[model samples]
Target: MNERNRTVVTEFLLLGFGKLHNLRILLFIVFLFIHIMALTGNVLVVVLVVFNQSLHSPMYFFLSQLSLSEILFASNIVPNMLWLILVEGGKVSVDLCIRQFYLLAAATITQCLLLAAMSYDRYVAICRPLHYAIIMTFTRQLQIVIFCWLMGFMLSLIVYIFLDELDFCGPNIINHFYCDIAPVLELSCSDTSSVELATFLESFPVVLIPFMLIIGTYISILRTILKIPSTIGRQKAFSTCSSHLTVVCMYYGTLTSIYIFPPSNNSVDANKGLSLLYTLVTPLVNPLIYSLRNHDIRRTIAKFLGTL
Candidate 1:
């Protein structure tokens, strides 16, 4: 890694499913459809939560924030993916790639934090019903949401700052659809051990700690549900959490698979597929999951649709 032999790389060629010669156009169409649907669904949720007084609880507020973060997350990745699809292999400037990486990281980390916060909200509602009102005040919810966003950006900023120290010498090719951290690091000629170590250590608090919080909260919630003498009461309480739990499993399962325990062969294709689940599929389906499972969202959506 001699500086004299190092050549500066100003742009990266994203080899995004370029081998799918027969399916490039088809992939583009499918991804475009997903992008549109996911955007529309998340936007509707945000609008409903903002305008509908009935949907103004801490849970709904967190849902709206999750939707907003998903919107940002998907937007940061999908457009570039679509471009890569059409071009077969798209080139992106280093500066633009760094920006995309930062935004994607921030949005996703924000969503993770929001999900943890949502679980805490549910725990308060189910386990401490009497104190729910006093515990999750409007100001407190706002503060929690703000903290999630701030922590997300600050953590991502630390990683972004590390990228500044690395040098991409040559072979400016990223095997994934977008500029993810691992793929970008692979192309760098610098000693990326520190960067890799930082990311690994960072994932603990960023991913594991929040995930563990959710698990602990849910365990308490489950205990509270079991204490209810009536079967109907238990079912009713479980219903409150089932949707969030479903989303949590789906989001974290794919995320941990790709990042925390990346594939043995370092299969870029496998990572891309998993990435699609959280980025495209989850965002599109999240609204449907919540709207179908929650009576309030369904009723509001039904009434809103009936008028149109």
Candidate 2:
């Protein structure tokens, strides 16, 4: 390798949001508001789920986990983004960016597994109502939740460990808001094939498998709902699921576009937009989609707020 390819890079230049820096103050204000809103929305869901006796079910349990993951997910990127936009020459240490990548991946995979768990919970409730309580016991719920977090961390940890093998030379400018795995890989002078392959192997299970499971579960759910004899019963069943489905569609849909789509000659700016969809938009929308459409959550929030 050329000496240039082996020189150690201490820091990376992060071109956040590209030309949007022309309106840096405005963008910072906008993202600050977004960060606050995302935190509030997800935190409220988690708080409601924890404090309210009514939402102490397995579904809400998973929802609370998802909310927490959303908080971490957005936190992994947004604050730094706000900080960078407020400053000139946005940059981060190599160590900091790698850590950020680890946490971001963990948050993302946790949500994916949690969503799958939620889908399974829905399946049990909808298709086998009698066996729901028996199957989704407290031990099982805790096990599933723990598994999601551990699995998420473990997968990202694998990638992080492997990341140490790759070397970044000078000209270490990352053309995106955050240290996204792909763009960061593009900067490495060392062979990233192993890490890329490992990332794909690890990410595939979290992304593809959980998504497949969710789809299968929902298919069964749809069939079960169709078999219901009463229109009101069907409406109630559909209402219970419509929110989750909407969020799932949006979440997985955007992720599929970002991950599964073959990387092209498209500008990094284009890919950043896709990242914004999941990293920013999904977290904010999840609470609105799940809570606003959810009568139980709405009532619980109202009751909790009324006392305060």
Candidate 3:
């Protein structure tokens, strides 16, 4: 390759959503509403957990972490997306693109592991109630959270570093809203076999392993629920798991659609839409789901509100 050919591209044009000039304002207003809801809801969860002494349990600890992760995850994509749609006219620099991709992937992977950890916490709480305190102590939860963040960043960093080195001398238009790996790869001039392989290998544990563990935990939880003799007992158990299950289904469902199916130009567009469900909608729904269904969170919020 010539030196001129090796020159790095400076910026990238995000072909976000579509160029329906007439629909730009409509899209902007819709996204603004979603973004505001996402931020407010997640932040409320964090504040409630922080201020409520009664909610200082292992489960709520993890729940707060998940909310924080969701906030970070949404911020990585939504603000930039809103900027593109409204201010920058849907354009982003190459460095900014890579940074966005890295943050999005890192936050997403962290949430996956955090959910699994929360499930494990629930498993221990339900299946081994007496030992839950010893097993899921503050130190232990901190360790798990730290490990999740570190592992997620390390894995995503490898992919981002490799992608930075790849030549993107072909089409500069990214067909999706944000700087996702699949869409970015489609624009690369150099071969992406290595990057694809790396993504698959690195993403396996981040996705499948945690997914299996969550399923196993829930199965065990369900078996325990069935063994309960009282109707109220079963209902209580179901309520505890329901919100988490709802969030999990919404998140994993969209993620599976994006990854399990092969990425194409059309798939990229579809993926962006699906990404909104988990990245934006799920966060907005999470606090509401937990607050409405989980008695603990509701009580905490009510009590906190009363003090004001």
Using lDDT, give the best candidate's number: 1
Ranking of all predicted structures according to TM-score, beginning with the best and ending with the worst? 1, 2, 3
Query: What ranges in model 3 sit over 4 Å off?
Result: 1-8, 262-264, 267-269
For model 3, give the RMSD to the true fold. 2.0
TM-score versus the correct structure, for each prediction: 0.97, 0.95, 0.93
In the range 186-216, model 3's lDDT, one tens digit per residue, is: 8787889988998889777999999999999
Backbone steric clashes in candidate 1, count = 0
* Candidate 2 residue lDDT tens string, 66-152: 999999999988888877777744879888899999999899899999999999999999999999999999899999999999999
Write candidate 1's Cα lDDT for 132-158 as tens digits: 999999999999999999989999988
Least lDDT summed over 10 consecutive residues: which range in candidate 2?
262-271
Give the winner by TM-score.
Answer: 1
lDDT for model 2 comes to 0.87
